[model samples]
Target chain A: MPERGLLIVLSGPSGVGKGTVRKAIFESPDNDFEYSVSMTTRQKRPGEVEGVDYYYRTREEFEALIAEGKMLEYAEYVGNYYGTPLDYVNQTLDEGKDVFLEIEVQGAKKVKEQVPDGVFIFLTPPDLTELKSRIVGRGTDQLDVIEKRMEIAKKEIEMMTLYDYAVVNDSVPLAVEKIKQIIKSEHLRVDRVIDSYLKMLKEL
Target chain B: MPERGLLIVLSGPSGVGKGTVRKAIFESPDNDFEYSVSMTTRQKRPGEVEGVDYYYRTREEFEALIAEGKMLEYAEYVGNYYGTPLDYVNQTLDEGKDVFLEIEVQGAKKVKEQVPDGVFIFLTPPDLTELKSRIVGRGTDQLDVIEKRMEIAKKEIEMMTLYDYAVVNDSVPLAVEKIKQIIKSEHLRVDRVIDSYLKMLKEL
Candidate 1:
């Protein structure tokens, strides 16, 4: 059987541009990994293509998958169920193709509990101040709400300790470049590739 | 003090083209790391420049440095002492510049003992047959010598388990690319870059 592929997770504090960077990586022509399209029970937005943006599922269908233990990680947001499908991820990985997941910090933590070996990357802002400005720039929140978000963002930044990498999203291309390098290097990591050499040595 | 730079070591079995890959890397204008030129007690060879090729030293001077614990790792071969100078490596790394070392397996092991956190990369031949062919292609060894060299190569290949990455020397360019990725990713590892984020969080 071909070697299993990496489960690469990109996640971090809110407004860290994790989605932008993940989109940039996928938009790149040389991307070889499969994007793990999420499943959600929410209504589809305008121009959102099925299986492209998300796999829109009925509430019953989503809950059934969750009950069957087929959701890699799932979370309810405003009564909408959103999650990665365990079956899709495992099938793609089993086929020797990497599965990319751009998730929230809490969802990433759940993924970590289930797949400890996944390459968990934390895309951080240049600093806390930059993160605050990004959140403030959203302009939809009141001052108190922004402060509350800054507090939550501070807590999420602390979760960087749980990740395998902390990439500063100073620029989309630069962050994408670093993430690509991380994936390439992870494939060459000894723990992941040494078994073949060990077997080769035994044969020799 | 600035963050300490990574100690990147490239090593592998004999005739695995470690020197070729290293030369390719250094020749690239984008290469950022400093190559740790070795110091040796051997007589200067024809057309070999001191410091660029090696830091030529007398036996007495080499011994003096060794006695003073100035060598990062050293070995004796053909009545000559060859070793990496400890001061230069530490000084470069202290200045927040990476130091790259391309050495043999034994010297790599010694460097590992001293710098366990260093990024150690083992370059392996595609397979035993390819390794044997490469050794035989040297055209200087008798059958018995070739056999003995193969045995030694086998043992060195087994030492790959000690490394952080194993790069197959299938093609020099491919191997160089992988090494470049490894270095880039190594710089992003959480353990290496997390301190700054932790400090940022504390201030926040």
Candidate 2:
């Protein structure tokens, strides 16, 4: 039997380019991990698929999943509920595909508490200056906007202590390469290795 | 300041081509790891440098290191002493180079007790059939040799649980790729990441 896939939670502060790194890593069809599609109450925007982008659910349908304790971690933003569906993650892992959850630091810790097997990774910027540049690169010069982001970045950086790994987003390609290596190496972890070898050799 | 290097203990059963895998990974100059030059009382063979191949030492000097508790792991085979020096490993790591110690499973456990921070990796063969083929591939048909080696392989395979990671040596190049990935991923471990970012960001 094939080994079950890893549950990976990739998180970072804003302006760390988490989405860009994710897109780059998954750009190739050969990548084996499964990107988690979140369940949301928000209406679908243009060019969004039903299940591919988000599992859209009505208020009752979403509440039913919460009552069933299937939501790994959920929060309401702007009167819309959004959460990770635990069953989908388990199903994907059962299919032998590593699951990737792109989340904020707080959600990462919350998901980690629920699924301790998840590998929590923090993507850090090279420095505060680089982070500020990336934040402003999104197109803005407002003083308060940059200051507020810098403040949030400080708190999120401290949350890295709870993570299992930290990779600097020095270059998008390099960061993606490091993440790929991490996922590959994690498959070689002793506990994660299949017991078939032991069983086969022990009979000798 | 640069990050401190990892101390890696790579062990495997006989006929697993551990040495071949090691050489392939370190063949590239870009690899930052250092191979440990062992101290031994054995006579230097041709093409072996004093410190490069082995730190040639007299029997009395080798005993002194053993008595001083300076040898990380040592064994007296054929009236010749062979052992790893703790000081050399520390000096290389202090110079920001990862140290690789290719030893047996027993020596790995012994060294791990002294340096608990060391990363232990076990290399397993593809299967017992592959192992037997590799052993026979060495052009030895002696029943006693094959039987003795098979017995030892079974024992060492059982000890794999003591390792942090296990890579299957299905092919030399692929095994080397897996080992390289393991080393690269290890550097991203949370505890090893420097707090420079934290201190710098908090001052904002």
State the TM-score of the second chain for every model. Answer: 0.86, 0.82
lDDT of 1 by residue, B123-159 (tens): 9877643564555777877889877866776676569
Displacement of residue A110 (Cα, Å) in model 2 is: 1.6
Whole-model lDDT, candidate 1? 0.88
- TM-score between model 1 and native: 0.85
lDDT of 2 by residue, A45-130 (tens): 99999998899999899999999999988889899998899999999998888999988776788998988877888998766435
- Each candidate's DockQ score against the native complex? 0.48, 0.47
Worst 10 residues of 1 chain A by lDDT: A195-204
After TM-score superposition, the amount by which residue A75's alpha carbon in candidate 2 deviates from its true location, in angstroms, is 1.5
Worst ten-residue run, lDDT, model 2 chain B?
Answer: B128-137
